[model samples]
Target: MSDKELTTKKYWEAYYKNSHVNKQHILTVCSYYSPIWEIFISNSEVSKSLIEIGGFPGRYLAYLANRYNIEPTCLDYNSDLTQIEGSFMEMDVQHYHIIKEDFIKFKPKLKYDYVMSNGFIEHFKNYDDILDLHVKYMSENGRLLVMIPNMKGYIQFYKYLVDYKNLKIHNLKCMKLKVFEDFAERHNLSILHLGYYGGFPLGIHQKINFLQKIIYKLHRLVFKYFANDKLKKYPSKYFSSAIVGVFEKQ
Candidate 1:
């Protein structure tokens, strides 16, 4: 598909026009990232400034800001009707800055300590250029994070085969981890961490069928009761529905 047909201002404006479903999905996804951000804060000095390139109505950043008390900037094409109240869940949305502009052309007076996007890069035909744009505003030694739907992963592939109609509307590319590793190399960045998250058999948000959910529940019972803690945490490449990569600017 052409870049014009891909995710644009109009695309998102329409998507979030009645955004209750989208907000719920964003909250579900952000719950996973919240723990990851805690790990980042524990290891390094607190990140003073962070930005989400395509975040609109900024619920994800609001969740993070509430936990870490960091300054957040949401750069997106336009605003949505879904507003996350400052006091709603005790998040201080006052520090969150929402910028209505094209991320490619956005020039910040100050760089951010952490730059991120959730399901952002895959929208473009030239994703490598998008990655470049994401890293452009990072401070020295800052972290870069990108998360995308795993169209290549086993569980998602199964969905594509059976539930093609539901998946077709997103128009996502089958991006793999190697593409990100290559991007890091070309940009002179160091890969800090890379992994998959959100297993489909357990993650309800994948629109899993009833039979699969029942089987997954039974498996979870066995795994929880019979399996060792280490075995329970075993990584499965094929099961994850999303892939996350974090890189540091060199």
Candidate 2:
């Protein structure tokens, strides 16, 4: 499957249907969004306002609502998307230009302090389209936090070892900070802060508590024990399974 196909509503919806979008998943979204602080170092107060483009199940929305006394709106094409405690709505982000509906249509009246997303941009065939949308809706000096997958990670490299290497990861191509900086500049935005992390896919594993230590330990042990040593050429960290960037509209 190509990156475009993998990010389709059909694919994402199917995955959401299968996976548990529980508290652990919510924490994972918060973990990625929390890093936006690096973008606005001057802000003495904690984060308050935020907007999540692909706010599936409202996990990040919940996080923002619980943390700060602010409302976070979630927008997606899927009307069936889970609505949590925070503000929730369904609209095609890309086509908001046509309908002149949804939040973006009236964004001038409803600006935010920050804009955040996780594992959403790479799904698009091109980030340029999405970046423009983000730029239009983002407030001046408001921060944009984006998480793009870094395919060079061990998980992807290992697929080359197994037979599942056929899937193309085009999103990895634009994972560089340069790509983001270029986009931000084109839209008159600045790279206030940027970094790449997610070495071991540990971001998700961090959800497990000490009570689940035995389960996590056994799982790792099984892989280390039976896994091909040749496949383990990379260290525990692959450096770029995902890239997170925070930008401010200049």
Off by over 4 Å in 1: 1-5, 19-29, 42-47, 81-90, 161-166, 169-174, 201-232
TM-score of each: 0.75, 0.66
Ten-residue stretch with the least lDDT total in model 2: 91-100
Error of 2 at 96 (Å): 19
Candidate 2's residue-wise lDDT over 93-113, tens digit each? 111111122332334446667
For every model in order, what is the number of clashing pairs? 0, 0
lDDT of each: 0.66, 0.54
Model number with the top lDDT: 1
Candidate 1 per-residue lDDT, tens place, 1-250, comes to 2453355577667655654434445567568666457544424545588888887656777777766677788787775524533322335456567677777776777788878898877777677777787777889988888878766655566556445544554435536777888888888998877776654533333456787667557656754455424332554556555777888877
* Candidate closest to the true structure, highest TM-score: 1
Estimate the overall C-alpha local distance difference test score of candidate 2: 0.54
